[model samples]
Target chain A: MKTRLMVLAISLASFSGVAMGFDFGKLLEDRLNQELNKDKKTQPATTPPPAGSQSAAASPPATKQKVDAGQLGFALFGDYSPEEENRIGKQISGNLLGAVPLVRDDGLQRYVNLVGNWVALQAGRKNTTWHFGVLDTEDINAFAAPGGYIFLTKGLYRRLNNEAELAGVLGHEIAHVTQRHHLKVLKKSSLIGALGQAASSKAQGSDQMVQNLIGNGAEIMARGLDKDAEFEADRVGIVFAARAGYDVWGLPTVLQDMAALPAKDNRTSLLYKTHPHPADRLAALGEAVDGRLDGIQGKELANRFYKIR
Target chain B: MKKFLIPVSAFLLCVSAASAWASPGTVLRNEQLFSQPTSGSRVEANVAKGASVNILSKQGGWLRVTAGRSTGWIRLLSVRAGAGGSGGSGVGDVFGAATTRSDPSRVVAVAGLRGLNDEDLKQAKFNAGELARLEAGTVTTSQAQSFAKQSGLASVNVPGLPEPRPAQPSSSWENN
Candidate 1:
């Protein structure tokens, strides 16, 4: 009996180490108990929930991971000279626009685009032109493709409260484009070579989409970006958003929402996969906005361009 | 009257020749050039190579050159003469010191294995030697990770950390 208990302890300890940021130990124990109860001898109907399981309500899994869309975008922007970054942006813009049927809620797209333009102008990328688009999908995702192309998912759009939030998100995305962080990451991963290889292929349509999704996602999350990159993006994003007349609090608030999300809180999912923790990001954003914009409050210019219920 | 005019013309020619001779070698040097004279400032504007400068005087290892529109002095050693016989002095400018920082590119082949975060697991390539090289200071940390990812080991566990047993073992391994 003592040896069995020891085995359980070691298993739990090992499970905890492997499951960092996840509550898999209790789940594992419950499964073990279930197996034991199925024996020919006397079997307990149900096992007690593990001790840590009680706090499950407080912290659900990783559905709420903070995704550094900026890093994702920057990973696409290689460390080309400012001139090269601009040229690549133009090429990517032409290629992606030709490929994807971008979301065109005229009002929303224009509003987001205007905000994006304003933020981009303030962020000051002298060489590249910035373009923003809305995707028709309901998934809660926003992507900044290489070469200054940004796509906002309808799911993310429907969840936003106002222009400030949109501007805040746009600012983050713009920062990614300006910083060319995606390309820096790609260079880190050596995917820039793969891009040259990809270029040689004649693949188009769904094939390109598959290549893009797989290539792009692998490029960004592969080997996991350093935590510093996400932190810097948030810092720069807040400033750009604030300069573009969006309330500085929008970023923090968005982060709060993300932290409160249920289902995606795995450590790897939260940090290496998506980005830094939303809580950490929120805290960083708060510190950045504080005292920086003294007496500067932004007003939202709402119109037919966008409406929030 | 002819003799008088001839003497006067000769005198004028002599004066002109002397002035021309004086201008060519009038190079300034060091403290003598910077000493309180024409312009009243401790420092002069940045001087470029092959710039034209008028030498006011040549002192011990220094030259008082007319820098830009204003005249100031610079070390004669610091100034180089223009390509021609023109008595021009060189100007020296100050720049901030450059510092050496680590490069991420060098560590592309030997990165150490750490457990993968979900993001890292997605990668299909990685190079361990590059990561090890980085840890060994042979490459940069960023480069090491990059190589590890490229070599398809992005999600492999970091070597330094305690590892769990593999889910399955071969019969020879199990015997041990």
Candidate 2:
């Protein structure tokens, strides 16, 4: 009976990985096997299973199940393939640029990308082809698109006191990508399903679905991620910055600065609508950083930051 | 002898209490510790990289830290806060657990038209050229490393922070 339960647990564990939206079945399988092996090693000798059960455990039933190619593709590639996500991101990015001009300074753009890329390398999805841009708008805003695109408005850029602050902002956006926040939102919005149906049917209306998906994704982006997601991004962002050797206070300090800005400021209107008030963000961040990060002093690099700008 | 021991223990208690100011910080770069938190004050000592100091307090950008027996001020930028700060497993689980909640079936079929208002997001048009430009600006890892080296930013291994507790209902933004 214990062996049966163990087999069941292993089968469910493997299936759960696929069901949880992980696209890499092989990776998941390997991880599950490792976990199982680790558990076996750590099990107490007094509760050791019968010798016959050892062989049965060694070859779990989960690995023997035949995974269909279609099922495998769906399970291994998530709802959208990486290429599909990249294409969608490009289209949305194009549309976004159409609405707001990018700051055309090549040097400044490169500098931002360099800093952003450095911070992004420390993220979980390090291999993602990250791109960073400065939007030409004066609105105090930043954005992240699926497939590793991050943007910071010039207004927000100019206000940052140091590289750590800039890193904090970029890290927040990168956190969005690593967490797939927008992508999950897109998947949940019905637009992807409509596109999938149109594509499968070879209908002429597929183009319309594409446009709708893009539009809806843009609207979601503009409207902003859920408050929970925003808070999660803040925590992840600070971690990334701290991992990359920037002051963890950068995010909290920026929050404080934003909080200090008058509520009526036009520049903050869009940002305010899309995010929790800065005071709330600050309080959340303060709690995270106060005791945890108070020991390690990180570099602000203010002079170098100003020089690049 | 009992009275003497009691006085010694009381003095030690006071010392321990005084030493526990705040979190400890590590020096990121070689910097001067000043007698006063301000730059104009006399130099107390020259602290090198990787020195551990207990942060006593902060005066603007200067941190009051005690490195060894010397208690002085160091520029906030000169030290990295926390010891061996690494983005711990605490955060990984919080982010990993975020599942999509929106139901696709509830989405409105009618697509809206676009304009400048925030509501115009429904009608946004794609600009391929701008995307191409954005993609073109990506920097390679080596380039990023060089950039970091140029800015004197060195990677430090700080332990990841624990998962933040859920926000309290008393937050001021709840009204918004």
Candidate 3:
């Protein structure tokens, strides 16, 4: 009797964290007792109710564990809907913001959004709603979520000599979103587990819909994409910036600045870990762009660049 | 004359501010050094793929460099501005300090700041309130277009570069 009471107490404690109704807690205790009774083997396995009205009142989803390719929009081939992609991005971006909030500068945030959205316009992904923010951290890096969510650290922002450079950085991240690089990576790494978790998670009342799809926190951002994906982003990003009427050399210049940094700079630790060496990127970019960009005319806009206060 | 001086002075300020002056750089491939920043200018000298050049100044996509006795402008892409000779093939990294923090300004910028690593991200919580704030700052495409118009940044007709054919030499990055 004491053990059963302890089990009931544990069930109620766990369920209470999600702020479910007390009726649901009682239902869970009944389910717990049913499981304990089945464990003794003397009694036939008694199944818990599919869901008590109290639990059903919480509006849980269907209890299906099967996931087809279409649901994930498997990116290159699978057509994951924009709505699904936006949820993943929101969860990831929200987690990242939790780690490091926005820089608290309205002007900086406004400037970044304007510039990011302008460059994104050239990307031609009309279906995606782009949101850009500058992270408060001084760590020099940038990130892009699956659905048009992008960020650059304040440290990286400070390194920009002009708006062109900022456009270049934003363009690179924008390429990642347009390319669906993260979605592809997520799809490839943990398909079985993620799909199952995603299906199971839907039945819960919490807002972690596809939380299992990406695992904990914003760690996916730190899991760098493949070399070719990165290189492709660099190539595509340069064109994106150029097409937006900014100097073609903007991304290259940013890479040069990063390449020239001393190897020990902790600020670049995440960057180097998550990217090809700036030297390698510059070389690869050179191979693609030997004389192609020669005739292109664009703006540097050095004077109008917003200085971070 | 004063107008020309303005550009030259601004150019010099950029080079100094970059602090890449006299920085050791490795030429990624053989490139011709031009007397001016543009390709149409006179060719001063040709530097080989593995040659080391001293980065003197930068303007747009060009880097004025002194390779051996030849001092001229080279396409910035043709050279990487650091001491990693030929980059990853491991040629001139004898002291191993080639990539050491050499720029004073960069050193200052990097000082006293803790890096954001994988752990901090993995342990982060969801900030729904901040997410709302981020969404609030988004600009519509029309708003962006008008903003671009304010700066005279019209869209242009630039073709995307062709993806390079594979078969790059073994790179250290692949190991990662």
Candidate 4:
């Protein structure tokens, strides 16, 4: 029975990879077409619109419109190119991690890595190399950096009751990466160049001070966005999680719990400042999760991580 | 038949004395008690489960006792005289609506917040991310509840507690 269950789990994991929403193969093909178009524009209109670029006008009777990384270009730093977002996302992720002390427990690291690798296999973004790290701080926080880097705080470890919730967190961050929210923000704001310059300078600081700054930066990023952007991530996050076979209810339940925490007199703490008010997020999620994935739970994954402390 | 009857006849039907917490003396029987209040209207409901009542002041059998949350009244036998603490161990009870896996790759994602530590900051972060992903309409709330039943956390009384007084005529007890 155990072997059968393990086989089932393995099958589900692989199936999840194949089912990811964003088709990497198609996304890459679209990117190549965009490059050809640019070359044609440069060459007095003589360079053919590449082999696949012409038939892929996106307005075909049968073919779907092409969508490239740059087509998500509006999220670039005003730079209309695929390379720009990749470079920018990598740099931002690197600089951000350099400033924070990632959590460093062997057991947790292995666990996070194993789970993360499993999730990544499900994610199926071959172009993006996923790196998972745990931060040692007591702050209850985790965030996805561009370029597929996800970080978790030690404080997060102390209070978790099970693994499903962990999956929820990872899946949501995965959504952010897959949706190219970081790039979207860069494209929306002109921060990519400025951020790149900072990266080039090799900015250095103490963990405490750096954390404070990064925390503030996270708040700024969260606050400066369109509400729709966040909504998009939440929606996709559920898809990622549901497809992976974890209990989906944990998503909203946690939000409700957080929102229900007795409101503190002062909300100036860095954590609150950076994250969305749990209440608002909960309401948003409630609407988002209305009536989807009903009757999907099976006894297996629902009871999978019940041994949580 | 004689062999069967010999040892069987030696068995005695013994009755245990009730009111284990009374004053310095008597062994009381047929004891009954009501719950008391510790505080608020939302007092933990476990107190009324077989608790002893002092009848300090009662509109009825609803005497007050120190429920974890507050004081409240319970019928005389709502709580048994000898019963101590809530019926179950504080934690380890499972709670939440069950949901099936939507995608196998996204196990952690679909797992959503079920197993995340409530008090952890990482949980908060993951929660936010999950919130965003759920916007896509794939997540389900199916079920969510704490593992603890009568633990340090909040408690709700089983409704119509102690089973509504059994409907029977007073003469029946006298005949017994």
TM-score of each: 0.41, 0.58, 0.76, 0.43
User: Per-residue lDDT tens digits of candidate 2, residues B1-176?
Assistant: 99699647645644674566556556655678888766778898898876877676765456777777677787655654444211112322112211122123322211121113374444445556677788889889999998898867778776665567665553221122
- Candidates 1 and 4: which is better by TM-score? 4
iRMSD for each candidate structure, in the order shown:
27.1, 11.6, 5.7, 20.9
At residue A111, candidate 2 shows an lDDT of: 85
Comparison by TM-score, 2 against 3, better one: 3
Q: Give lDDT tens digits, candidate 1, residues B64-98.
A: 55654545565433343321211111111100000
Q: Best candidate, DockQ-wise?
A: 3
Order of the predicted models by DockQ, top scorer first: 3, 2, 4, 1
List ranges where model 1 is wrong by over 4 Å: A1-79, A86-101, A195-201, A204-225, A264-272, A302-305, B1-176
TM-score of candidate 4 on Cα atoms, chains taken together: 0.43
Q: Give me the runs in candidate 3 sitting further than 4 Å from their true place.
A: A1-77, A192-206, B1-20, B88-111, B168-176
The C-alpha local distance difference test score for the whole of candidate 2 amounts to 0.62
lDDT of each: 0.43, 0.62, 0.75, 0.37
Cα lDDT tens digits, model 3, A34-152, are 54344333322332222221231221121111112222213212345676678779888988987999999999999999999999999999789999999998899999997889999
What is candidate 4's lDDT per residue for A150-174, written digit by digit as tens? 7666655554555556666776677
DockQ of each: 0.01, 0.17, 0.38, 0.02
Lowest summed lDDT window (length 10), candidate 1 chain A: A63-72
Q: Which pairs clash in the backbone of model 3?
A: A73-A79, A73-A80, A262-B101
Please rank every candidate by TM-score, starting with the best.
Answer: 3, 2, 4, 1
1 or 2, greater by lDDT: 2
